[model samples]
Target: MFRRLKTSQIVVDVIVAVGFFVIAWPIETITVTGALGFEYRLGSLGSVLAGLVIAGLFSGALALRRLSPALALVIAWVGALAQMSLGRPPGFADVAIFGVLYATAAYGSRTVYWAGFASALVGALVITVYLTAGPMYAGGLSWQTLPLALVMLVAAAFALGLSWTIGALVRTAVRARENRDAQQRAEAETAAEQERVRIARDMHDVVAHSLAVVIAQADGARYAAAADPAVAAGALATISTTARSALADVRLLLGQLRHRQGDGPQPTIADLEELYAQVRTAGVQLRVDVDPAAQGEPPAAVQLAVYRILQEALTNALRHGAPGGAVDVRLAWLPDHVDVEVRNPVEPGAPAPARVGHGVIGMRERAQLAGGGLDATEEAAVFTVRARLPIGDPA
Candidate 1:
């Protein structure tokens, strides 16, 4: 929020510099008039305006205060040196000193921030020394003036220090707020990416599982129509049922894509029964066993994780297991976590599939996202996928 392009800042500073020039002109003129006239009934209006114009020119560096604080500081120093050379008393144009010092701390680079701090201390000392010794040079110097010099020094130091401190505090606040805003933006982007990944994974699971079953049933029907028409008829029925369910799942997923987060339907633990039945009708002997020990139902997020893992695992088995293989599904519920394992038979000495796919990766990611773990391995002609999911609420 504190940041601004230098191009725009330059224009703003120019306008501010003009404002300062206008205000200082009148104040400097009034001070000159009151000093020369009220004190000694002397001095012309034309002379007062001429001297004030020169002082106002020195303060013109305010135009670059924010855009280039170091440059502004340099210009301010030039003005101060000129005023001291002319032995001029304090005037409204001197306000640029505080303005420049404040800009150095609030808007400058590292070098300039510290440089402004040093200038504040040094400038106060210079002012006190110049004012104190001016009387000495005028032939009226004495020990009685030392206390007044000390008072002037203290007051000048306090004013300069206060300006720098306020600028430093503003700088710190702006930086802290920007950092917090950046962190929030990063977190939001991460959430959006994760949601996209999750949707892709779900679409893969639903379509892959349904199509695998349909293909198996269609192939079985193609070969068995003449010898046993009843077997062919049953296969077609299973294919129909699986396709309709897949179509509905796809429609729901598409709807989710069009809506805001949390507006879509989520699968839970109870959906596993229909999955097993679909696989069984594809001519694979599917067996399921569940041992319940937890007192209450799991959170929806954990159940969704468990469901997706099993769905993908069963899909893999149905597509790659040995022909007419018997798949074993087991679920063991614990107090704080649930365990799921799917085992399907393959050829006795067959090698692993030639190319690895995202099925295993997706399942592993799902488990980990739920604050748990998963493993998929093939051993002794049996492909096994095991996963554990925590029953805790979703983050």
Candidate 2:
């Protein structure tokens, strides 16, 4: 695919090209009279036609410097050859060579980038030989001429090498910046994805668990309304309270999803009491065993994970366990970690469900996020979910 050109850079290059043409419209050439002696000469202003053709080619290269640096380099060579052929001296127009070489290294593709380095080395040698050729023709070079030739070669090499090196450095810096930008974008995307999954899991736990209790209470209230009005009324109250709480929790989750502000504290281990009360109110016998910790409470991440996992497991028990069946919940807080286990008897008549439900998946994800592991299984008519979350562990 063709990359778009930078209009501003093209404009600047054109302006610079115009400046070179204005300064060197009539080109000149250098000539040496003696080989060994220090007798040098400069050619008179060359023919206007030769100057126009040579300078125009170099200016064209300058204009195309950033637009197509490889082509610009070719044009530069063509201009250099034309000046040598026309016996013209280097002039202000040759100034475009520095910009063209820099662009080739900074903007060109890999092949052209290396070609720029080749041009720097070979062009220096060509300049050194061409400038001294006249002196050699007049009087063959001797030991006296060696130092002058060496100086010319070293000077040419230094100027050209410096320009290419600066451009190469720019290329490296640009690539590094691009890599950093790409990495930041990827990290941001990953964080957003994780946030989405968390919201979905929380929503599922709240809605599914709350609705299951509301349904169980509603059914029981309908059957008991004739036998005991007070019992039916209490069931209705529980339903109302459960529904309001669920609505509030759902709203809280929604608020978190909608905006960054108003993010309240999440449920922790302490909230398990309210959860158990709700399960009992739904006509399920919940037996909870708590093994307190000597190391105080765990990290917030661990508490949140424990609460959510237990909530989900009990929610499953309420939804799929034997009608009025008993559930056993255990929590043991150790120095380094907290362990959670929930066990409920299954109804013999109830069909086997998919081994892992969405609730179970959400529980597993919560445990893993808190730097923990979870296992949920059904064996011998009993469903169990166990989790071990590390305290203050890096996630």
Candidate 3:
């Protein structure tokens, strides 16, 4: 509730209403002139004080709550009647206050807002007729006052209608702003969730692929220790290298998760050679046909995306491709674009692996983030994964 009203606005409203009543009460008293057949006097302290109190209360009530239109009209009628009976003579000035109040309340959708306007108009007409009753009986009713009364009524109605329209417009604008803010907040949350999922996929690819290679090498090392000590030592060396690379990858991923700005080294297209070496050590025969032009330069983000895509593809191949089968990796740098392909031959009767795993999804996401395209297909003993990245602008 406090959020809805400004302190200064509330203060201003209170002061204006109180001040108007204070000034209007004395004016109403001064209107009590002689020979009007009304027992009103501006010099009467008690009557002036009483009128001031009444007017103050009336003004304050109008500002307080959601006043009904009917109640407002009744108050208007009563005030008009009092002003006519107690003031000097019946005139537009006597009932103008009630008309203004009625219009405000009616436009505000208060209970007595419209009613107040209607009642004030009616009361004004009644007072006019009452003042001219004796003369009309002696002669005839005059039509001169009709135009003035009609003008007042029209003005009041117009003011009320315009204010109500403005209020409705303001409400609509406020609601639209609120809806837009809510939509923005929801979109931000969804983007954050998607980032989280992408990070999780990266972790899965890094850990699973590294551990799988380590496990295979350990097994080979244990088996060849007696027969081929040199081969066992080589396997141990591969294990150590795999473990260190895995640790570095983990640290980079954690830095990304923590939102650390430029905290870790990012892999680029050059890192693909090292990645190929790791896969080769894992017992996958990797045949590479990389473009010399694609060896050195790319945008940092694009480079990272390319590296991740290749990593995921290689990890998937090692997990599902036939043991000892050759995995072919092709990188071609066109004048305007870069193309990457990873394909492995599948053994006969091997079931297709899960398609929605983290590795596959992560590759797809990375390609998309880099403003590239990727396709995975399995047919006739061959599994192919291809990505095409536009080099026109860095991601």
- For model 3, state the Cα shift of residue 390 in Å: 2.7
> lDDT of candidate 1?
0.80
Per-residue lDDT of 68-147 in model 1, one digit per residue for the tens?
78888888888787666655566778888888889889988888999999999999998887776752234233588778
User: What is the number of residue pairs that collide in model 2?
Assistant: 3
Top lDDT prediction, candidate number? 2
Q: Highest TM-score, which number?
A: 2
The lDDT values for all models are: 0.80, 0.82, 0.66
Superpose all Cα atoms of candidate 2 onto the true structure and report the RMSD in Å to 1 decimal.
Answer: 3.1
User: Which residue pairs collide, candidate 1?
Assistant: none
| Alpha-carbon lDDT of model 2 | 0.82
Candidate 3 local Cα displacement, residue 91, angstroms:
13
| Residues forming the 10-long window of minimal summed lDDT in candidate 1 | 33-42
In order, how many clashes per candidate? 0, 3, 16
RMSD of each: 3.7, 3.1, 6.1
